[model samples]
Target chain A: MATVSLKNLTKRYGNMEIVHGIDLEIADREFIALVGPSGCGKSTTLRMIAGLEDISGGEIDIGGRKVNDLPPRSRNISMVFQSYALYPHMTVRENLGFSLKIAGATKDEMDRRVAEASAILGLDELLERRPSQLSGGQRQRVAMGRAIVRDPDVFLFDEPLSNLDAKLRTQMRTEIKKLHAKVKSTVIYVTHDQVEAMTLADRIVIMRSGYIEQVGTPDEVFSRPATRFVAGFIGSPPMNLHEATVSDGRLVFSAGDSLPLPGQFKSRTSTGDKVVFGIRPDDFYPTGHGLSSGGETEVHRVELPVSITEPLGNETLVFAEFNGTDWVSRMLNPKPLKAGDRIGMSFDLSRAHLFSAETGKSLRN
Target chain B: MKGFKPSAPFLLLLPAIVVLAAVVVLPLILSLYSSFTPFRLTRPETFYVFVGFRNYLSILSNADFWWAFGRTVLLLTIALNLEMLLGLGLAMLVEKATRGQRILRTLMMFPMMFSPILVGFQFKFMFNDNIGLVNNALQSLGITQDAIPWLIEGHLAFIAIAIAEIWSSTSIFAILILAGLLAMPKEPIEAARVDGCTPWQTFRYVTWPFVMPFAYIAMTIRSLDVARAYDIVKIMTDGGPAGRTELLWTLVGRTAYSDARMGLANAMAYFSILLSIAFTVYFYNKLAAARAQIGAEW
Candidate 1:
């Protein structure tokens, strides 16, 4: 197990600084995921830590040892690539045993480790097959087997499941979670999928434009987003964010629609202050169908004309016009509803979020 | 004529068939037929004298012809292998170059641009025994007291011809292998590094196998080129100094032109064709195996 520390880690290609100075402390065996949109430097930061990309000015300490000048191999970390970069010329057994062979391991040790990894990944039958002969999920398994065969101090995954189909991705996600539990190595997974980050990472580091927007537990980032970006980014159907001016204890939108400012942000936000009001689809649901956050549930009900209703078996997603834009509300024990129907929607103000319009920082102290 | 119509495809292919027959089929048939007869270019009457297997039988017992055949094989073997290794090195060097890669690739192909006959003449002058550049450089550098006969001596002549042949065609391997290197994915190399493979180990295990198919293809093309090697040897040695450095092509050329033994030369030329066929088949099989090893379609 290793604690990875990034102190002012920065990466600049030529004169274009891609990953700005970002510091983070990953505890031993902590599965940290760097999640962001494309070109947000999450991958760059991971690459810098892996030593695949050069760090412009920073210190990377893996297992409490400075590794700024170390090559990827010297750092004793294993990486699973997005393409499942198994050696095409080798069989599955050979692919798993390659790193050991390169390390000059004895034949018995190599075979033992290869067998162990294959058994763990359910690749015993596929040992003789080449990567091209295997399916996408099988190839992904072989890649993970290759990494675990080394028994590295840290495991680095660069969108390893991005290449798999949705069903297989979910299957492999569980396998990876189990694998992480079995190995218990420090993992730094980089992915653009927020759900993958939330499910897999012990802590999520949300980045935007080369800067770390927020770093917290999945629940913390979701329930209490530090920035307006995090609130909209971390959720499945993304939080509904609307620009508003706090006036007379009410958030007034540009379209003259108003919401009573949540009591928690009363001390942080004042009248005439422009802010971005945020609420999740789960928090804003049909009346009597809303879920509680277990604290004081100060919910406000409003009737709005439904624009569309998406029935997803158990629960339906109702899209309705609010503040001159579509605000999605989840209907638990969903009732039969259609477009043009006026339904009372509940807004969970206790779970609501507010961020300054000038700076997207949250107004909840 | 109204009822039995000529096939439309055959009619369309008529001109190409006629041209192939005239240029390729006619010459092959004429040569095969002539090899069975005691045909002499100088005496037109001897062309009809049926010799049956006389030419083939004579060549089987001829020590000089066998020696030339052996020498030709040796030259092809040595030249093609050395060219492949050098070309691989050159391609890797160019691939690693960050800037001016386009210019470097163009420059790398300079030797390939020269006609083989021109290259033969150029090397012939460079390897001349008395006042050649090689001996002059060796003597001036005090590496040799006397002039080293680059072309006159048997082994020296073979080496000189091989060098000239390698110089002209190494770029063929380089260009094809460079294309392979360029098309290779960067992820595998990075993965290799992450898997604890040293740079040399990565090259040995990953890069080399990926490019082996391309190298074999180059070998196949150059093997056919070198198996029928005639121009460089003709220009440089011409089976000189009691035919010590004589190759099959030089011997066949002399027999066909100088001795006026067209039938014997045709038989020898047919034997040389067998050598080319053998090398081509071997390289093609190797190419297929390499492609298969990489899980690529043959």
Candidate 2:
């Protein structure tokens, strides 16, 4: 039973403070991901929880026991490094059984645990090979197998799939999810890839500049981002965010083009209020090629010139010129479009977002 | 037949081959020939008298020669092992220094930069029985009332020579091992800690294996450099009172120069060269095995 908690957790390196006081609580058997851009303190927070880095101004509780001063081994946690840190001198069997050997487990117990982990990771045939002899994917598997053999209360993964090729990364992502299900241990996975966090995690914690921007399930973070940063960060082809001023009933962009203020922020905003407008590529599409079925209210249409089109197999991303910015819009069902062609683009206002220009916070309640 | 013209590659290599034959091969063949003769430097005309196996057979039966041979092997074995251990310890300490690492590494190699002859003199003075720093310090600290005969007694003089040799060469091992430590990735150590290893266990299982190849490389180099200690032993004890610290090279030097028995000296020199070859081959094999373990991982 491992429920990790960080209260007012802070990290400081001499005169510089990289990670400010942040709080998070993780439940038992829950798979959570802490994801952000580089230098956003995501990996640092994970290492702090792993007992690798010292916390400057807070307490860490792992399995209901305060582990602030405890060493990493006593914290009952295992971490798979970004580079699979397999012992090159040892064979796969020895690598898997090293922790058990150090723990003074009997030969039979060590072999049994090693065999179980190897079987789970499909590393049966490669047991006698050294880490130098294994391929990248196989090495990653051995690293995970080593972690599993220890049976720690918590599993910490620091970008375990980032080194793999795209196809292999996808395959390993599924394998990690399966491993988590079978192991049923509390896993805190850290990565910059939002897709990995979205597909694998039960909850996603998006961080920005040492602060957690939002924490929600995949659907919630995607559909209802809490901040403008999250809205732009969580999607591929990214959400189109434009800065504008609220004048009368319309949000007036700097390029003199205007979009109707999203309906949800009507009560939360007023005239002359500087704000940023946001809409996902899915919400802003070619007029007839949108995903929203019929009966959608507050749909604004404008005839705009298609700047570019990126055809991605089934659907294409249409870049339309709006407010002097090339806004990304999705086109469905293979609409034959070209550059400089005028297209009727639709902005689903009901699904749009408005954020305060000052704080970059969402204006919706 | 066409004119026999040398190829460009062979022409380019001619100078090197000529220099090698003149400088290296000629002397080696001459010495080998001399070892089989009963030639004396004083009796120059006796060089033509080849008394086959006389020098070799006499040295084989001489118990003094055998004792010198065995003592030389024992000294090298003990000195090399102690240097490796101390060098490993020193490297680990220097590697742990967070700041001033470059300065520490340079300071660690100060002993290695000193010439072996100079080191022998320095240690000889320090270990002198009557007026030496070691006995003086011991007497000042009230540890001993007598001036210990550091370079006089047989075992004590041997210890003195080993100390001088280790001091002059241990940095070779330390520098190489330190390079290994610096090039090591920090991830494996962190992984080891998380894998429930104590600090000692992490060092034993991870750090040592990673640096083993470097240590073995240093061992191979120093083993082949056994001649460097010859000057040190010659300066400090010179085979001692009653030949207590007599090594093969010391005996060889005395026979060739003092006794003018060039043929016998050449035979003794050949035997010592064989010892160096055996050590080099052994260490080279250990180095290859160590490299096989972790070389590809890097």
Candidate 3:
């Protein structure tokens, strides 16, 4: 296991720069996930670390040794591709032992390593079968096993679960997490699925347009996003933002209604300044009870027309329109609320996020 | 039922079937029937006289016919194998070239575009003993004082024909193998590199196996083509000085047209069909096996 660091890494395809000056320090034995949308350079970043791509500018140090000039074979990193690129002609056992055999490992050592990896991956029974004879999940296991037998300093996975079905993806996700915990090897995984990032990563690095948006623990990024982009990207049914202005010591919406500002942020901004207020869906509840139940602080209230109610068995999602913007709220025991029904909702302003209107930066920063 | 009518597909295929019968089926039946008779082109009535495989018996025992048969086999083996090897090497080299690859591929196909008869004439003139450019150049450079009998000697004549054959057909192998290289999945190669395979090791384990079926396919095609080769050899050596390079077609030509023995020639043609069938079946089975190994539905 080793720490992997990228120092001012920049990737350019001719004049267009894809990944512009990214610096990341991944500690030893940490599971870091690079997550982003398509064409966001997350996969490119991982490929650069694996030495599959040339480092246009920057240094990649694996275990404190710069690997920028090394080839992928000499870098001693194993990668599991998105397509589960198992050798079609070789059997599962041969596929698993291929790296070691090429590296001039002894026959006994190769056999032992292949046996151990197969047992760990539950692939002992299918060792004699070729890649064409295996199922999708089995092929994925073989791909992983091929990497496992190499025992490289770092493991790189490029959307390894994307090809599996939903149930299989979830199953393999947990298996990968457990495998990481068991092996305690430094692993760098890349995927576009935020849920996978949330569930699998020790530290999640959110990327957009080839730039790192935010890097933090999943909860840290979820509760305290660095910017409006991070705030909107981290959660399911993302955060809602509405246009508002500070007028006469009160936050006034475009509809001309006044709402109370939190005490900590009240002294930060002056009157006549335009700002946006952000709130998560699960932060709201059916009103009449104040924002605070025990010792928690109370905040503001808004009355709006309920647009739609979605019942998800345990909880309900309530959609409401306020200040000409649609907002979704998570409620407990929501009872058949129909469209055009007036409902008073309460919000805890202490947990609310505020952003500048001009630059989408967080106001608290 | 009163309002039903037939479809247009049958009507569209009726003309093709009629054309096929007239062009292919009729000639095949006529030749098969003539194989059983003592047919002569000059005396047309002799075609009806039943010979009961006497022509086949004579050719089967004739030293000249068996010698020609052996020579044809040897030519096919050497020419086809050499073409495959050279083609495979050229395709691999071209595939690695990042720049001007398109132009290179187009240039590689230039030899295939030339008519075989034209190629034969060109090489025959180049290898001619007294007035050929090759001998003149060698004599000018003081390499040899006398003109060599390039088309008369047994081994040299065979080598000359093989060289012509190779130059003409090597492009077929290269084009087919190039297609295989282009269609191959790049992921496996990347994975192999990450798995610590050296360049040669990667080629041996991954690239070669992926392209074998293509090579075999090219081989089968070229084998059938060379087995029936006539135009080029007919122009260059004309089965030559002592019939040293006599292939099946050259022998059959002498029998049917020059010797005016149509029945014997027909018998020879029928026997040679076995060579084509054997090669076709062999290659077909190999192609099937390759597709099965790769788990592809052909």
Candidate 4:
């Protein structure tokens, strides 16, 4: 395992820079995920670290050695591509042993290493099969096995599970986590799926456009997002956010509905100050519904019309009209609610987030 | 009642079958029939006279015919190999060209754009002993004192013809192989690089095997093309200066048209077909093997 560090890492295409200079330090044996939408430069940063791409500027050090000028092979890093780029002509055994063969390992040594990798990946049965002969999940495993046999200092995965079906993706997610635990290598995984990042990463690096938005543990970013982008991006059914102005100790929406601002944010804003308010579904509940029985709850009473409800077996997602837009609220335990039914709700002010409208930065600090 | 109606597909295809018989099969049968007889275009009555393999036996024994046959084989082997190698080099270079790659590919195909007859005429004049650009350039450069007899010398004329053949058709290989290269998946190449293979090793173990099927396809097509090649050799040397650069097609053309010996020419044509068959079979098997190696099928 090795610590990988990027010092002001920048990538430029012609005159237009796609990845702005950003610094990140990845600890040894840490699984760091870079997650963002397409064209956000997450993949570019990963490729730069893998040395598959030429960095326009800045420095990348892997295991205390400068690797910016080094070739991918000399950097001692392995990558799993989204396409699972297994050599189509070679059998799984040959594919796994290719790097060792290139490095001039003895035949017995290569065979032993390949065997160990195959066993770890459950690929012993498919060792004689070619890539085309294997199923997609099997091919993905072989691709991982190929990297495992190399025993490189670092592993870089660029959306390796994006091609699999949902069920397979979940299965591979567990497998990858297990593989990391067994291998204990410094891993840099890139994905657009926030759930994957939240589940698998020791720390998630959320990127936008060309810059790193925030880097923190999943729970830290989830509860204490540094930017409005993170507040909206980190959760599923995403955090409900809206533009509003502060008026007489209350946040007034464009549609004229107002809710009391959390007392803590009173000092962060003055009357008529524009701010973006955010709240996660779990933090809001119907007064008599799940988690609303706590006597100490400072629930601000509001009556709103329920618009939609997604019953996902264990929990039902309730969407209700509040401040002119639909706000999703999570209902745990049991509550039968349908569209157009007016329900009395209590806003969880303590969990509310306020961000400066102009800067899109969280105002808590 | 519905099942009893005429089958539309076969009915629609009947005209095609008739046209193929008239344009292809009829002539094929006539040529096969003619090969068995002592036919002559000048003497129409000789069409019916049976010759019973006499043409075949006589030609087999004829040393000059064997020399032309051997020379044709040599030219085919040398020209195809040279063109493939040159084509691979050109395709790789063109693949690497970043800006104006489309224009570069177009320029690479320029030689192939010319008709073979035109290419033959072009090379013939270019190889002329007295005033050809090659000899003139050599003389101007003080590389050779004498005006070299390019077409007059047997080996030199063969080289000249081989050069013409390779120059005109190398693009066929380049275009096909370039297409293969373009269609190649980028991930495997990157994977190979991460697997620690050098550029040459990547090409050898990954790129080359993927490209073999395309190369073999081009080879099969070019083999049939160069087998019955006539116009170029005719224009360049007319298989003359003592039939030095004679290919099978030139020999067949002379016998059938100039000598008016249609029966013997047909017999020789049948023999030449064997060469095409051999090449097509060999390349087809190789192509199949290459496809199997990569687990890809058309």
Candidate 5:
């Protein structure tokens, strides 16, 4: 395993720059996931690291050696593509041993390595089977086996689990995590799925519009978002931000509802400053005795008309409207709340987030 | 039975059946019946006479017929193999070219655009004895002091016909193989490179195997086309002064129309059909095997 460092890494296609001067240091044996929406250049960044794409301007150092000019093979990196990309003609044995054979490994050595990889992946029985004969999950395993047999310094995955079904994706996610743990190799995985990034990454790099929004641990990024984009992107149902202004040391909503600001923002903002209050769906709870009685617990209460209720067995997702803005709240033991029903809900202001309305930057930062 | 009846399909197929009976079925039955009789085109009254396998026996024993048959096979083998090799080389080179590829492809197809008869005449004039461009150029370069008997010599004439045939049809192979190259998945090739395969190794192990099926398909199609090659050879040498380049078709034409021995010619034509069938079946089986190697159903 080796540490990978990208210094001022930039990628441009003609006049339009995709990745704008990204500088990151991935430590050895650390699983760093690059997560973003489509066209956010997450995959492009991984490809540049893999040497599949040329770095327009930057230096990529692997283990203290600059690998900007090196080919993928020379860099000693293995990439598992999103499509699996197994040779359709070769059997699983050949597929796993292809790199070894090309590198001039002996027949005995190839067989040993292939056998070892197959055993690790539980593919010993599928050595003679072609890729077309394998199921989707089995093919995914074969693809991983191909990469593992190489035993490169860095493992690059390009949304490898996106093709599987939901359950299979979850199972393969765990398998990949276990494999990474066993190998202890530095891995750079790229995916748009925040859940995958949250679960698989030791450090998650959230990217937007080719720029790094936030890079932190899952809990850090979830609980302490650095930007409005990260606050809105890293969560499942996402954080809801409503326009508000600080008036007389209190936050005033657009719909005439007023509540005192949380203590975290007391020193950051002055009166009459415009800001946005952000709250996650799960951060809201059913109000008890109104917001005034909850001392030291900064709670803001609001009455909203229920738009829809989605029951997901354990918790119910309640979609409600406030000040013409749709917001979702997760409630425990939520019954059949019909549409147009006005319900009083309380937001936990201590868990709430604030961002500057004009700049889209976190106000608490 | 009532539920199974579909009168619409049968009604729709009625015209096709009638056309097939009139155009294909009736002619096939007539030919088979005529093969049993001593039918001569000039003497139509002889059609009623039963001859059994007399025409077949005559063709079987005929030295000229067997020689022409063997010559056709030789021409087919030489022309098809040369065309395949040249076509494969051209396609590989074209596939590697990044710029001006479209222009090169279009230029390569220039030969295929020409009629076979026109190509034959062009080559014939270029290879003519005294006043031809080839002879004049050779004399001007002092390579040869005298005009070479290009059309008279057996081997030279055969080579000339084969060259003309190769030039005219090599594009068919190139285009088909190029299509295969375009359709090939880029991932395996990239993987092969990352696997440390050299350019030659990648082509040998990955690229060539993928294109073999396409090459076989082109070969099968061109074999049938070249097996019936007559326009060029007829215009160039007309089976030569001593029948040295006597192919099956030329021999059959001489016997059928010129000598008016229709029965013998029909017998020769029927036998020659075996050559086409053999090649078509052989290449088709190879195509199937190649596809199977790639785990494709077709």
Candidate 6:
């Protein structure tokens, strides 16, 4: 295991810069996920760290040794590409043992390590099969197994699960987490799926437009996003952001709706100040509907007509008219409220977030 | 009459069949019939005289005919291998080129665009004993005082013809191999690099194997084309200088036209088919095997 650090790392193609000057430290045996949408430079950063892409202007240190000048083979790192880049001509066993073979390991040792990796990945029965003979999930397992056979200091995965079906992706996500625990190697995984980042990584690095938007644990990033993009991107059903103005101790919306300002931002907001208010679906529930908000939690109750309801087994998602837009709210317990039925909805102000509309920066400490 | 109309599909194919019979099948049958007779182009009435297997037997006993057959096969084997190597190198270099790739690809095909006759004549002058470019360059460089007889010497003429044939046909290998390289999936190559394989090892294990089937296909095509070395050898050395550079085609063409011994030439031509067919079958089987190795059905 080793610590990988990037100092002032920048990547530019001609005049167009893809990864701006960015610095990051990945601790030993830690799993860090670089998560973002497409073209966000997350993959570029991972490729640079793997030595597949040259660094334009900075240094990468692996195990306290600078590696910017080294080729991928000399870097002692393994990568699993999104295409599951298994050799089509090789059997699963040969694919698993390729790195070992290239490193000049004895045949017996190579067989033993391949066997161990296959056993770990549950690929014993499929060892003799070619990649074209296996299913997508099986090929992905072979790709990962190839990386594991080498036991390199770092494992880099570039959206390795993107090619699998949703069910297989979920299964492989857990397999990767378990694999990280068993291998204990420093890992950098890139993905556009926020749920994967939230579930698998020890820390998540959210990127946008060549800049690191935020870096924190999943819970921290989810509960307290640093930017509006992160706030909109991190949650399922997404956070509802409404533009409003601070007017006489209340948030006044353009659509003739108003709510009392949360107490935490009292010193940060003044009258006529424009803000983007963010609230999660789970934060809004029916008053006296399910679990209490807790005695210490302040809840502001207001009556609103429901517009739509999506029923799951345990909870129902309720969408209602708020500030001339349909704001999604969660309804716990059974509620017989139709689309036009009015019910008292609880607003958990302590959990709300406010950002400056002009800067898109959160106004929280 | 309406219900008895000719079958449309058969009607549509009648013209093709007629043209094929007129242009292809008739000549083939005529040639087969002539091989059994003591026929000459100048003696049309001799076509009716059948001397079954006599021409074939006499030619089989002829040592010069056997030598020409053996030499043709040897030239093909050597030239095909060399061209494959040179073509693979050229394709790899072209694939790595970043700018002006279209122009490079176009220029690589210039040799293929020229007729083999032109190539042969061009090389003939280049290999002339006294006024040749090679001898002049050698003389100017003070390497040798004597004018090298590139076309007059036995081995030198063989090498000169081989060089002309290879240069004209090497592009067949390059274009086919380049198609394979273009269609290759890039993931496995990058994976190999990450797996600690050097560039040479990557090419050896990944790129070369993936392109093997294409090379085999090109080999099969070129083997058939190069088996009959007529126009080029006819133009360059005309199988002269003690007939040191004689190939099967040059020998048969001379016997058919100059000697007017059509029966013997046709017998030799039929026998020569075995050599090219043997090469084609071998390469085709290898091509199938290589494709199967990559798990490609087509």
TM-score of chain A of each: 0.98, 0.99, 0.94, 0.98, 0.95, 0.97
User: Each candidate's DockQ score against the native complex?
Assistant: 0.86, 0.81, 0.70, 0.77, 0.48, 0.81
- Report per-prediction Cα RMSD to one decimal: 1.9, 1.6, 3.9, 2.9, 4.3, 2.4
Global lDDT scores for all candidate models: 0.92, 0.91, 0.87, 0.91, 0.87, 0.91
Candidate 1, chain A: TM-score? 0.98
Report model 4's TM-score to 2 decimal places: 0.95
Worst 10 contiguous positions by lDDT, candidate 5 chain A = A287-296
3 against 4, candidate with superior TM-score: 4
- Please, what are the lDDT tens digits per residue for candidate 1 over residues B137-187? 888999998888888888888899999999999999999999999989888
Candidates in order, TM-scores: namely: 0.96, 0.97, 0.90, 0.95, 0.88, 0.95
Judged by DockQ cut-offs, the docking class of candidate 5 is acceptable
Per-residue lDDT of model 5, residues A1-365, tens digit only: 49999999999998999999998999999999999999999999998987778999988998879999987778888888888888877899998998898888999999998998899899988999988899999999999999889888889999999999999999999999999988889999999999999999999999998899999999999999998889988987888888899987788999877667888898999898899889888776444422333453666777878888888887678888876667888877656678889889887888889899888889876
Q: After superposition, how far is residue A182 of candidate 5 from its true place, in Å?
A: 2.3
TM-score per model for chain B alone? 0.96, 0.94, 0.91, 0.94, 0.92, 0.94
Q: Considering summed lDDT, which 10 consecutive residues are worst modelled in model 2 chain A?
A: A259-268
- Write one digit per residue (lDDT tens) for candidate 3, span A1-365: 49999999999999999999999999998999999889999999999998888989988999999999988899888999999988887889999999998899999999999999998899999999989999899999999999989998899999999999999999999989988987788999999888999999999999999899889999988888877888888787788878789877777888876677656677778888888888888676557423335544755676888888888876677888877767878777557678899988977777888877777777884
lDDT of 4 by residue, A134-210 (tens): 88999999999999999999999999999999999999999999999999999999999999999999999999998
Indicate the TM-score of model 1: 0.96
